[model samples]
Target: MLCRNCLRATRAAASRPAIPLLRAGISSVTRSATYTTSTQASVRHTLQTRLPALPTFRTYSTSSSESAAPPPEKPDYLNEAESTIWDRLVAEFEPTELVVQDISGGCGSMYGIEICSPKFAGKRMLAQQRMVNTCLGDLMTNWHGAQLKTRAP
Candidate 1:
């Protein structure tokens, strides 16, 4: 009984708020930025292409061959405490490279030890570190903390 134009007029009822239709052509949005000296409302990262490239199948390196530089000689310039820890690690692991530093300034309370040894060659990283900690014995207790890095030769 109803005409086509009459049916279309009843569809948009009065209770609902009308949603404006979005037309095309906006290519970018303008953002309000604040000074670095003042508090910022939000921080956004806009650089997309500068990120590390997607990895190839089963390959991680960006280069053809990774020829690493040889490590430095066992440093003789270490203070007495650093040398003692270095000596113990050298004897136990027979490390190809070792660097020990007193990271707690002049206090000798904390150490940073990086050791690369053939003993670590076949082991997982966590196991190699556990081995180093075990070998350090009571030396582990005397320090407030240590930044220990162990790797296979």
Candidate 2:
């Protein structure tokens, strides 16, 4: 069965005959035909004409003037502390990618991470999350809190 809202929407849509504009796509044309429906009356509208095709996207060669910069190197302290923990966990359970985002305010201590790992494969959502928490272990004692997004590789 169709929902009441859906039926009302369909009736409203049918009542208005969408007028197409050449500048944009079907969406713009449809939006141009929009009208308010009164609670007291129910009536259908009809489209006056067919809409024109959507405008094609233009591509510019910005690369000709601009060059891509190399990614910044991971700092030594990051390698020593956070990277050490990551390396240990990755050694035990390899991952396709592990992203650590430090949100520790001015002091720079706490962090949030997004880990995409094959180790999480075949595991339930809660189990995957728990694995990350377990891997952090005692190190998390110093952290404010962590937000983790773990997905199967």
Candidate 3:
């Protein structure tokens, strides 16, 4: 025997109006309404109304207005004291390759250093780093942070 609830639901559905669907010169098929959920509509509205306009970026121009002056013969970041850090490393380790960068916007507060030296050959990574820190000595007090890379040549 058919369920009474199912029979009632079928009768109610038959009495309801049928929805129209988009047709490509063919028989129609039912489709859902176009309205979006509240969350989706809100996200779309925020993206359209609340977001700021995109910024315009310009490329470096070598025109006469822009000074082509040979980059000041040295980096503008390192002051005399900062430069001395690399100089001292060179004096003590005689590194094969050395690169030292003042990464604190020229304030001489932080450094990133890379050095390859025979002096570090037998040492563990921590020991090598300690050696460098020990060499910095008093200068370490003024530095905010340091990223050091050391290798045996």
User: Which has the greatest TM-score?
Assistant: 1
Q: Which digits, one per residue and each the tens of the lDDT, describe model 2 over residues 30-130?
A: 42234444321222212213434569999867672254333234445564456766665666556667766666763537777777776788999899989
Off by over 4 Å in 3: 1-78
Candidate 3 per-residue lDDT, tens place, 1-153, comes to 335763563455456665543333323433233323453344345545745677999997677445422211234666687679877887777677778888888888898988887789999999999989998878889889999999886
Tell me the TM-score of each prediction against the true structure. 0.52, 0.46, 0.48
lDDT of 1 at 43: 17
Runs of candidate 2 with Cα error greater than 4 angstroms are: 1-79, 106-108
TM-score of 1: 0.52
Candidate 1 lDDT, tens digit per residue, 1-153?
334652342243223443332223222422223223121111112222334567778855654234443434668789999888887887788777888999998798899999898789889999999998998869888889989898996
Candidate 1 clashes between residue pairs 3 or more apart in a chain or in different chains: none
Point out the higher-scoring one by lDDT: 1 or 2: 1
Candidate 2 has which clashing residue pairs, if any? 14-45, 15-44, 15-45, 15-46, 16-45, 17-46, 17-47
Clashes per candidate (backbone, < 3 Å) = 0, 7, 0
Best model number under lDDT:
3
**Global local distance difference test of model 1:** 0.67
By summed lDDT, the worst window of 10 consecutive residues in model 1 runs over: 37-46
